[model samples]
Target: MDFGVTPHDGLPLPPRVTICEVGPRDGLQNESAVLPVAVKAEFVERLVDAGHTVVETTSFVHPKWVPQLADAEDLFRAITLAPGVRYPVLVPNSRGLERALDLGVRDIAVFGSVTETFSRRNLGRTVGESLEMFAPVVARAREAGIGVRGYLSMCFGDPWEGEVPVPRVLDVATRMRALGCTEISLGDTIGVATPGRVAAVLDALIASGIPVDSLAVHFHDTYGQALANTLTAVRKGVTLVDASAGGLGGCPFAGSATGNLATEDLLWQLHGLGIETGVDLRKMVDTSTWLAGHLGRPSPSRTVTALAGTS
Candidate 1:
């Protein structure tokens, strides 16, 4: 319980970090067992109860492609939106954005790939075509006075095409930023990023005139380097992080990808370092454990398992 630690000299870590909980949307969509709408609603509410300010509620992709989140509208209808909590949904295109807008959603995100292969596999379009698809969505969202987030997957590496070139990643990121994306989340979709690579990518972005405050990091734990990569990003001045509760969810399109960095585990590390996130570690662990039970499995988060005493 005592997370006190002596200060390290000149640590560039931010004093506070904002955790964007993606369990309800990103986490549940990849799940094989489709949970009831009420349960998913409860999961989002519980995350809010645990002091998460931003929770990705669901995606508006076609039900045929992602059946797990087909109940997106139903889930929104079933849940009570807490005041001051930002619930963003994923919108794959113009229609997806329309669906989100119909539900009175204030924030929406568009997913893109930095590589041509992943763009074709995931979005069914090439990288250039996907960017063209997002341009209108981002423009309309901004015109509607809605906040738009751009999710660039495979920022570190890709499964089909191997390690993606840094220039290609930067080009897509710059394009997204030009499209009026208020915030951009860099995704380690395959969990192949190390601390050095993380730093290099972030530094490149910074050099390209991307503000650190406008950037967020989303890392996976496939190679057990997510925490280290996240820490490196945080120290490089990124405050926003995307994580799934219980370390749930992987890229369905990328077979080699693994679960995201767990909210509980990220919280444990951030809180231990005396960085404020406003999230209750105990409540987050409890939320993860509760959701794990519904998923018929134990939590994948080390912190959750240790805190909840679930083997």
Candidate 2:
């Protein structure tokens, strides 16, 4: 498949892309085992050493909800923060925001859902109610000089509510942007989005006045369409993409939502298309390999699997 092409206007792809590594947080959150703070810190540091600038270190949610990341504060304090590298944590509400702020975190991300069922199931609120909840969180984060990224989950299709419309996703995204989120990441949580669906959503978002630069794409490889969907988004001029090192995480709410788009897998496609991600593929492979050992399993990333076989 020819994955390189501007889907519209025949424009050249961006010179560089930003890959946000969400392994430490999103990747491990759904795992059955909880890694110790020291190991988690080491995993993050290795990712930074591998050249990821925006690494999502952890989430500030309640420990009972995501016990895997219960040591968010300790993990954040233990990691060595390098200059020019961002450590963004996921803050689900004002309480999470407060926790992040207490640790002097500069960047945080908030999540919202397009479908009513997902919002209610994932956040214990309706769609409108969830946005209302995020309003104060985003406002206070901005007041505290924190950069907020918004995540809209189940953008393409919801397991409970199948075939979500683009406008519904755009509506929530627009409100998120208005809530002062610096960027919005459209998440295909169930991995049901194909390349055409991905392109359609991006086109609708861009056409609705959302700057392509302010948008990011997050895909799960459950159905093996992540790279293709990513390519479609890039062709639509998106610059920021989310991936997990070693393809670690899945959505606990969505039963079928499996492994995330792997950092190594996304890098392979981006590098092949001549798009600079400022990431060392070899180093990423090694990091994924090391992480897989810690997880006591082989990496789900095709690139990591292939490279490991050859190495």
**Model 1 TM:** 0.98
Clashes of each: 0, 0
- Candidate 2, residues 1-311, lDDT tens digits: the string is 22453235566688899999999988999888889898899999998888899999999888888888889999999999999999999998999888889888999999889999999999999989998999999999999988999999999999988999988988888888999999999999999999999988988889999999999999999889999999889878999999999898999888999999999889888887778899988888898898788888899888899887654
Error of 1 at 84 (Å): 1.2
Alpha carbon lDDT at 278, candidate 1? 96
> How close to the true structure is residue 57 of candidate 2, measured as C-alpha lDDT?
94
Q: How do all models score by TM-score?
A: 0.98, 0.96
lDDT by residue (tens digit), candidate 1, 1-311? 85757378788778899999999988888889899998999999999999999999999999999999999999888889899999999999999988888999999999999988888988889989999999999999999999999999999998877887888888999999999999999999999999998989889999999999999999999999999999899989999999999999998888888899999899888888889999998888888888888999988899987889742
The weakest ten consecutive residues by lDDT in model 2 span 1-10
Per-model lDDT: 0.92, 0.90
Per-residue lDDT of 104 in model 1: 95
